[model samples]
Target: MTIQKIIRLLGRFFRPISLKWRLVWRLVVLQVILLTLMIFILLGGLTIAGVIPDNYEGRAIDVIRNTITKDGSGNLMLKQGPLLAELRKEVPNLWFIAKDEHGHELSEGTVPPEFKHITEALDYIGDARFVAEPGGSRTTATVQWAEDTAAGKVQIFTGAQGEFHIMALVSVTPELFLEIILPVGGVMAVATLLVIPLVVRSAFRGLRQAAVLAERIDIDERGVRLPVERIPSEIAPLVRAVNGALDRLDKGYERHKRFLIDAAHELRTPVAILNTRITSLPPTPERARLLQDTARLSTLTDQLLDIQRLGRQAQQFTRFDLVAVARGVVVDLAPMAFAAGYEMSFEPARGELFANGDRTAVERAITNLVQNAIEHGGNAGRITIAVNSPATIEVSDEGDGVPAAEREKIFEPFYRLRPRGHGAGLGLNLVHEIMQIHGGRIELAGSDRKGACFRLVFAQA
Candidate 1:
């Protein structure tokens, strides 16, 4: 497999394990491997430096030979001297048996019953020799030894019956285990337990700081960045990539805001010139119609600019009376409603209704809703502005109500229910943008009497 694929597979397998535990386990495995190498090195060094004797088998044979000899009657016998006692002290479970030339037992200690038949058949006499058999596979009986070789058997004995014979069986002692393996293993275990946790926690400290910094970043806080210094090298590239993406987004947003402002500025001069020329014409029906069309165009242009401004403007919030704003918008639009043969009225709340928001933006939004009601509330000729709570205002008209399917689309920018020339279709979209900037929302609700009710909900102060 490819290196990357193998790395990903390993990550998936180990992902469930906590970082701390993963580090601990790896350290422990390393310690075990190092300890094994140290043991091998120590043994090799001791042998090379002659600190540990390598001729243990030859020395043991010599000790056994010296401990056994023939009496005056030609029978084998064990010497009861300090030399034989010293050998027994050095090798735990040490025992010996001897036989004479006549095939008769002639020693103080007897062999285990299972080995009696085999010992009786031994018939050679020469230099001392040793034989080893794995415990379960022994030709005669079972014997236990040192912890590392609990089921092993060792025999150092003479063979054949024509002369003297001596047989010795022994198990290795615990002193070898204490001297060679324990000290090194104890040191390694202690180090792994004490040092790994602090090391793992220190390594992850940078990642935690990066997480806290990332959590606080948003569109408004685009300039903020996670610090790469002191971060682990393994994760530095990912953090850099995220910061790069944020930079691109901030640049694109600024460019869009600039284009909207420039376009609005460029259109104002031509629209004003058009209005002036229409007024200079002689008084006639055509001239009057041109004047009306120019006024509509001017209104549309203003709405377009409002849409652009509200799209980028951050809300400047203050505590203000929402009911007062709704009443003011109704008063301002009262002349237009009367000219369109409609009656307009504002139902003021019993008490002042206050909300936290930009007062000018809220006033513009209420104006748009009232204008939409005047245009679409077909000849039923009645519009009502109501303040239901500190954070809510509803404008309803007496006209053919909006269709269920078309209600949502009417709020989209430049989307109108009717064809061109009836309205510019930016009114509701501007209102929606204003509500969003103030951290509020707008919704179209069904009116029980007729027509549609558009509700503006703001955050309460």
Candidate 2:
């Protein structure tokens, strides 16, 4: 495949994995590559410098024997040669000194001031060698060894009876650091890098749980909280702040619900009294108009109360025939449709369509849809309530269809296409809320006929 297509395919394959895990894996892969490169560079440098021979110990002994000789005076000395001069030029930071069996300096070279006491330097180097090779004997001659010292790094070679001895001290210069210390440090750093992602993932486990809890929360889950313990200190403040905001919202929502309930209760008594008084009045057109207005006002107040009640209470879902409920609502409102000069019809689905929802709320939602159709269906036109399989109810009117722009806004509280006199505008909003509580939705659908269609979709029982 093409490069771009291959990349796209890879992206799709990895997309199901969470971002955190993807990032962690990427970091691990990068660290592995960097560590491999570092190790390669370190090995290449040591090989080029002749520090890591095929047999390091044997090569060291060979080099020492070749460089040192016993003079006629029985003193150890470095032989003069092009090889020695070349070695000195290549590693200028290094010092070579030969010492007798008594640890007296014999070779011609300046040791660092720190090692002016030859016996102490020997003791220090011997101690370092013992640590590196614990079972090796220090008194053995013809032995060659390398060790770190206070002055730098030293390689020592000795002959029997101190017939000849040689010390090669390599200073801790920048080049030496690159040759030894940098490689060792890089290996340690790579080990640390390999472990970091695991540590980070472990630390973020609690935060991930908090995120999941937050995702499940909505208006209904007002007092729910994310776990605080085990959460990292860096993220604890944000969780606390979110919980505090939820607390404030719950209190404010409770107050709004209380106001709606109280207002509805207070208005019910006056509206009842007004109805009674209106019935006793002399029959007249004006009296009839006032009664109609009062009835509309009472309906509006009841809808507001239903909105608050639904918000405060949880759904009591049970399996019930949705077609039956739709038929009943249509029957109840059929007379109202006739009175308003509209033809109301219920087209029931052929088979039983059971759904899981509160029956009362479902009936109420259907009632609102029918009433809305009657109000807006225009004089003497048909309003159809159709119940279909999987528990779907569609209510359509033979009036002017809702404009595309106004359909969404029509569901908002107190929103109307016309003026305030047409409706208090809580009917559709209450219907929407009830459907939402049922885990269903009410959608404005396109009607094949010349009218508006509203679909109420419900989950199958």
Report, for every candidate in turn, its global Cα lDDT versus the true structure. Answer: 0.68, 0.70
Residue 393's lDDT within candidate 2 is 96
**Candidate 2 per-residue C-alpha lDDT over 1-461 given as tens digits, one digit per residue, 9 for 90 to 100:** 89999999999987787656666667756765665566556655654444432233233334444666555765556677776665555444444444444443444344444344443456445422211222442222222333322222334633211111112222223554577556765675576566766787888899989999999788765677888897999889998999898888889989988988999999999998998899899999989988988898799889988888784244556788988888889888889899999987788776668888788888999999998888887766899999987679999988887887897698999887777555688889999999888888999986455888999998777
- The candidate scoring highest on lDDT is 2
All candidates: TM-score: 0.58, 0.65
Consecutive 10-residue window with the lowest summed lDDT within model 1:
161-170
lDDT of 1 by residue, 1-461 (tens): 99999999999987798878877888887876776666656655654443433433343345555555556765555567887676555544444454433543444344545555555445542333333343542222222111221111222342211111111211221443466446766777678778878877788788888889999777545567888886789889998998898889889977986887787677778879998998998999999988888777788878877776663344556788888888888878999999888898788775688887778888999998998988888856689999986578989987898887897798888888887556788889889888877878999886455788899988777
Question: What TM-score does candidate 2 get on C-alpha atoms?
Answer: 0.65
Whole-model lDDT, candidate 1? Answer: 0.68
